[model samples]
Structures are given as C-alpha cells and as structure tokens.
Target: MSQGLPYDKITSAYAGTIVYPPKGTYGPRMQQDLQLVLLHTGELELTIDGSRHAVKPGQAVLLKPQHQEYFAFAETQESWHRWITLDLASLTDEEQDYLDKLPFSMPIPEALNTMTDMMLALQNDYLRQDELMRSLGYSAFQMFTARISLTKQQELHPSVVAALGYIRQHYMEDIALHDLAGAAGVSPEHLVRLFHVHHQMTPIRYLWQYRVLKATELLSQSGLSVGEIAARCGFKTAFHLSRLVKEQTGSTPSDIRKAAWGTAN
Candidate 1:
C-alpha cells in the first residue's frame, strides 16, 4: 500500500481467485473489508446473517464488512471465483459512502469483467515496488467500483431495467420497438407508455437517443471515423449520424472532435 494517492486511485488490501470442489463450503467466518466477488463457474449460495443470495455465473456481488457469512458450493459441481478486496481506510469518506449504495449483487458488464480480470492479474505481486504500477492498480480498482455502483435517485421499473440492460448490451444492432418490448416482457404499447412515464419518451426514441450519446463519446475520444462510428452505433449512414449529432447536440462531429481533442478525434 502507498500514501498520498489521488482520490480516483485505491490501495487495495487483497485480490485473487479461488476454486472449490463439489459440496465444499467455507466460513461461518466474518468479513473484514468491502469485497467484490465475480463467480465464473457453477453456482454460489451465500448466507449472510439469515438471508441467502444465489449468484449465477457472470454475476457479481459486493460484500460489506463485519457480516457473518457462510459459502456453499454447488452439490454436484466445482465453483470458480475471483475477487478484489478494498480497505475502507484507503478511500476518502465520500468514496466510502458511495460504496454503501451499490446493489448487493448485479450482472457484470463486459467492460467491468475485463477490468476486474486485469486487476486480479496484478494481485500476485501488486505494487511491491513500482510506484506507477501501484497507481494504475489503484485506478483499476476505482474504475470497477464506479462501474458497479448505479447512482439512480430511485428504483426504476422492472421492465425499464430489463430493456436498459438489453439495449446497452446490443445497441450496435438494428433493434426495433417490438424487440425492446419483447425484451422488457411487455406489450409494445405498454412498454412505450412505461418509457414515457420514466424516461419521458417512447421506447424507440430512447434507443436512437442512446445511439447519439454513444456516437458523441466516440467522436470525442475514439479514432474511428464518422462512417465507421455510425455503423458501430447502429445508425444507417455517416450523414444520419452527423445529422442526429448536430440536431441533438448543436455541434458537428468535426467540431466536437476538434474541441474535444487536440484538433482531432
């Protein structure tokens, strides 16, 4: 661990992977720090106090400190898991408070999974001597923490939650209103009304709007050209992407690129 690191960086306590044989169990033990676990194979059933959580593969759970818990591996299979532990004392008070609000468990996004795996790779000899590598490890931990924490003011409708996860996972595809409705497990008209109630727009409108938002990020940061970005973002043509960017953001892609970077994107 190091001192005087930036707020966006972290000094983690420990991180590593574990594997358990069938019917194996651990704990009746106590947690010492905030930890995030990513289960990779088989099922995990964790009982904290008296409540039980059944986590599937590709899912993650954030554990708080000071809880008595038991871990049960699948009765008929092995379980593979990866985790990163965060020391609360290493983070600022604001950062500590933010961790308090994360969902106990959630699906791991693809980007977050990559970041977590990268962080775990560093766990063997993490920050033993190199200062810059230490800082990078810290920032990696910070990145996953920020990603897992969904800072909504209120809980969204279950249908909206399902639709949002679907759109985010497949925004590059040519998605239709019916597809969105089907993913949300609602009728097309019902999904539209729900979107209007929550997002103040129809389901289809939100999809394109979200596409424009993704295009803006690429325009401001990625090296991809407008035409390539359009295809990646589900727009029909470069002109279509440009027109929407101009209409929604009051700026052309070129202007955004120039202003965002040093005369380029």
Candidate 2:
C-alpha cells in the first residue's frame, strides 16, 4: 500500500514548455521549495545533490528543499517538461520526512497518469483563477502528491553535494576549478570529472551560467545599469556581461531591461 502525503492543500501549480539552447544549462544550485518535474517529451538531465539522473517522457524529478540540483536539455535536442512547486511548510513532519527520503527521480506510475494529466489541467485552472477552479486545482495537486509519494527513491554523493553548495554560495566571486576541488576535498582532475559526470559541464562553466542567471534577475528587477550589474554579478566589464546575456538569451542587456520595465508598468 502507498503512503499518503502529509499536506492537505497545494498552494500553487504550473505547466509550461522550456526550450533550451543547444548548449545551454540551468542550475547546479539548491532549491528553496519542493518541486516535481514531469518531462513530457525529449530528455532532461539533472544532478541532484551530486547523483546524476536523466528524466524522459513519463519520468519525473522530485526536488526537495536545500538539495543541490542542476538541469539541462539532452544534447542538441529540445525538452518539454511539466512541473509543480509545492510548499514544504504545508506538509506535516512525517510527510516532510517521507518526502526527504524519496529518490531524486522516478518513473511516473501508470496508475498516476490521470493525476499527471490533472497537473496540466490544474495549470489551466490556476491561470483562470476562479474560486471554484482554484479549489479544484488545489484538490488535484494534493492527490498528485499522494500518488507521487509511493514511487522509488535515489541517493546522492555527499562530497559532490558539499562541493555544489560551496560553488553556489560563492559564485558571485571569482571562482577557480582548483578552489572548488579543494572545497570538495578532491583532486582538481577528479572534481572536473565529477562535474562532467553530474553537471555535464566543468565547474567554471557552471559558475558562469549561475552568474548569468543572477544577472538576468537583477536586470529585470532592479534599476541598476548594465555596468553596475556586471560588476556585482562578477563579470569583468559591461561588455562581458552584454556578450554573455546576448548569447544566452538572444537579447542585449538594454533590450532585456527595457522589456522587463515595460512588463512591470
């Protein structure tokens, strides 16, 4: 028999498709909340707390709070992943402990297909935001969590998890591969291999992507100019920041700022 979820309500839900650049990557950082991601098409690779896993159609990645996870599309392919973020505080201590013990990735059981479908349906209801629809969405989300709790679980490599934490906390500064390796208490070469095996990129590349992501948030939410944002985000100059932003997002820093401001107003 399956165990029930500790929570009675889902605070929020979302469904969307993300197109990753052929060589692009996202995250090697800790999640602030619990997130369940269902990959509908293509492939998505993730390193959860140093253990690497690949999620495909009908497979889901369950990310617990404070777990260091990073994701990227399979090489040269596009991925369509559905996701829902749950509020961990809503869960009872027992439920939270159960969730914490589950594997990072698992197959979405055939019986739970309906609930997976409901996730997308819930996404629609959430967007509509009508009282009845929202209530229904919450119910569906609760059922989804209940079913998910029964799946198999995976483990993480402690050393890699620690190394990822160090990188995430200090990414805003100039970081070197050896520095990361030292922090992980591993040889520099071994750390590079760990990064490749797990993150699919070198430590420095992961650091760069992390900085760029932070810069994008600042660009959209703050009044800081590109030059200031560059320095704050660890870029050597505005030109470096602009080039990377354009490469990663296909838009210049000025254009991104304008678009963000336009949306805010």
Candidate 3:
C-alpha cells in the first residue's frame, strides 16, 4: 500500500503525437509546458538540455517546465509515440521527489498498462466534459509517481549539492567554471563531467538556467521591460536575452509578459 501525494484536482490536458520514419528535423526546438511521451513503437533519442537519453517502445519521458528539449529518430527508425501533457503545478513535493529519482526516460511494463490506460481514458473523458475524469486523472498521476518511487533512489553527491547551491546564490554575475570547481575542490574538467552526469547540463547551462529562472520571476512580478530584464539578468543585450529565452523556453520576453498577464487575469 503506497501512500501517494494528495492532489486538490486534476484536469484533462491537450494530447498529440509525432510520427516518424521519413523526415528531417521535426521536433520543437524547446517546449513551454510539461510534456509526457508514451512510445508505442520504435526508438527516439531525446536530448534534454545537453544530456541525451534514448526512449523506446513501452517507455515514457516527462519533460519538466523550463527545460530545453529536442528529439530525433535514428535512420531507418520506426517510431510512434502517444504524448499528452497536463499542468505541472498539480504535482506535490513527494511526487516530484519520486520523479526526480527516475531516469528522464524509462521503460513502462505491461503490468502498469491499466494505470496508463486510466490516464488515457481520463484524458478522453475529461476532454468530453465528464467532470469525474479530473479525479481519475489525479489518481492515475499518483499511481505513476508511486511506481517511480518504488525504484531505487539515486544519491546526489555532496559536491553536486554544494555546486548547485553556489549557482543558486551567485548566478547573476559572471562566474567562471574554474571558480566553481575550486569551491567544490575538484578539477575543473571533473567538475564539468560530474555536473553533467547528475544535473544533466554543464555548469554554465545550470548558471544560465538559474539566471533565466530569476529573470522570469522579475519579469512577471516586476514592471520590467525586455531591456531592463536583460540587464538585470546579466545578459549583455536584450537580443541576447531574447535568444536565450527562445532557446530555453521557446518564447520571447514579450510573450512571457503576455503569458504572465494571462495567468494573472
């Protein structure tokens, strides 16, 4: 009997798929929302930030908010995926912990088919205006988290935590990789390697992520324009800020402001 996280509610979300086997680049450069991929057939390689992971049939991948992601099929690849996404604010801390332990992409077995089916069914029912589907969606999400929790936990190295903390505190200004490496008391190269292994991105990428996250808060909560926000976030220019935001969030400064306003109202 697994104790699942409590959820206030769950609502049906948009669903879509990308069929492969004959194309050039076909995936979005970056995603703005939470995304889930259910692979039904073939293989797909997903690049989340700078880390690469392979997802196969009977497996799934969940993309967290604000992460940069891209995917491509191998040549002669036969791949089909069923993807759907719901808002991530619905996940509790306990459920999020479970999710963080699992690999970005992992296999799903037939034993969990019923739970997956329930999610699919809820997606359909909720889209069709069946109010009860919300409850079922939340239940299905809890079950998914429980399954991930049953897997072994991966310990975060002390150095990684220290480095993460350093970034969180000092991301606004320019900080060298060697400075972080020295703080962690490891060789610069080793620090880069280890950070990539655990954090799934280079230290610089993490720094950028931290800056962007801060910028987002300022953008939404403060009355800052693109130029002001860019300067505050340590970006050289508004264009640079726009480029980074587009790369990481698939949206520009104006768009983010609009989105913030939309949410507020």
Highest-TM-score candidate: 1
lDDT of 2 by residue, 51-157 (tens): 77877777866677767888877777677766656553466676667668665666665423443454454444345233223323333343344344322112334
Report clashes for each candidate as comma-separated counts: 0, 2, 0
Ranking, TM-score, top scorer first: 1, 3, 2
**How do the candidates rank by lDDT, highest first?**
1, 2, 3
Runs with alpha carbons beyond 4 Å of true place in candidate 1:
1-10, 90-98, 128-265
lDDT of 1 by residue, 124-209 (tens): 54452333223333443444544542344147788988898888888999999889989999998999888877665677777886
Q: What is the C-alpha RMSD of each candidate to the true structure, in Å?
A: 10.9, 18.9, 16.7
lDDT for each candidate structure:
0.69, 0.62, 0.60
The CA lDDT at 166 in model 1 is 85
* Candidate 1 least-lDDT 10 residues: 1-10
lDDT-wise, the better of 2 and 3 is 2
| Cand. 3 TM to true fold | 0.46
- The lDDT of model 3 is 0.60
Per-residue error for 265 in candidate 1, Å, reads 29
| TM-score against native, each model | 0.50, 0.44, 0.46
Model 1 residue 130 CA deviation in Å: 6.9
